[model samples]
Target: MKVQVLLRTEGELAVVVGEAEGETWPEMQTVLPALLRGVADRVEAHGEVPDAAP
Candidate 1:
């Protein structure tokens, strides 16, 4: 899988994420929680973070 991080703002941010080709959405779903938590923590602590896209 490939992970791309994006900085949205000083206090709020977004993560631009995508998996490698042939990866299933279900598979990605498995790790979403961890990814989101990590992003939230980083955003809170650092003021900028990245996460999965809608």
Candidate 2:
């Protein structure tokens, strides 16, 4: 199985996109948590940093 995830920041919000391929549920189960955690970390970091004054 193959899994890919992307996280993007837009203004004060964030977007998460994920994809899974192949028929390997077991592998996905093992990797999904880590992938989700990475996205969460990025979102948290983005939240902690204030936007530049406009």
Candidate 3:
């Protein structure tokens, strides 16, 4: 499994580019989420998120 990260004006996107070894999107449904979870964790840790202000 090959994974890559990309930066865009809109936001960041997780891109996985690899040769087809059979199941694609269906498999992506599972694989992608796990990958995204890791990315989200890191983002939450390093990024400065704005807190709610009242």
Counting clashing residue pairs in each candidate, in order, gives: 2, 0, 0
Q: Candidate 1 — what's its lDDT?
A: 0.56
Instruction: Give a tens-digit lDDT track for model 3, residues 1-54.
Output: 444443233465644432222256676555665565655555567667477121
Tell me the lDDT of model 2 at 3: 75
Better of 1 and 3 by lDDT: 1
> CA shift at 26, candidate 3, in angstroms?
0.5
Better of 2 and 3 by TM-score: 2
lDDT of 1 at 8: 71
lDDT of 3: 0.49
> Which one is best on TM-score?
2
- The TM-score values for the models, in the order shown, are 0.47, 0.52, 0.43
lDDT of each: 0.56, 0.66, 0.49
- In model 3, the Cα lDDT at residue 18 comes to 26
Off by over 4 Å in 3: 1-3, 7-22, 51-54
- Report lDDT (Cα) of residue 2, candidate 2: 72
User: Where in model 2 is the C-alpha error above 4 Å?
Assistant: 11-23, 48-54
lDDT per residue (tens digit) for residues 11-34 in model 2: 654454566676778868877877
- Predict model 2's lDDT versus the native: 0.66
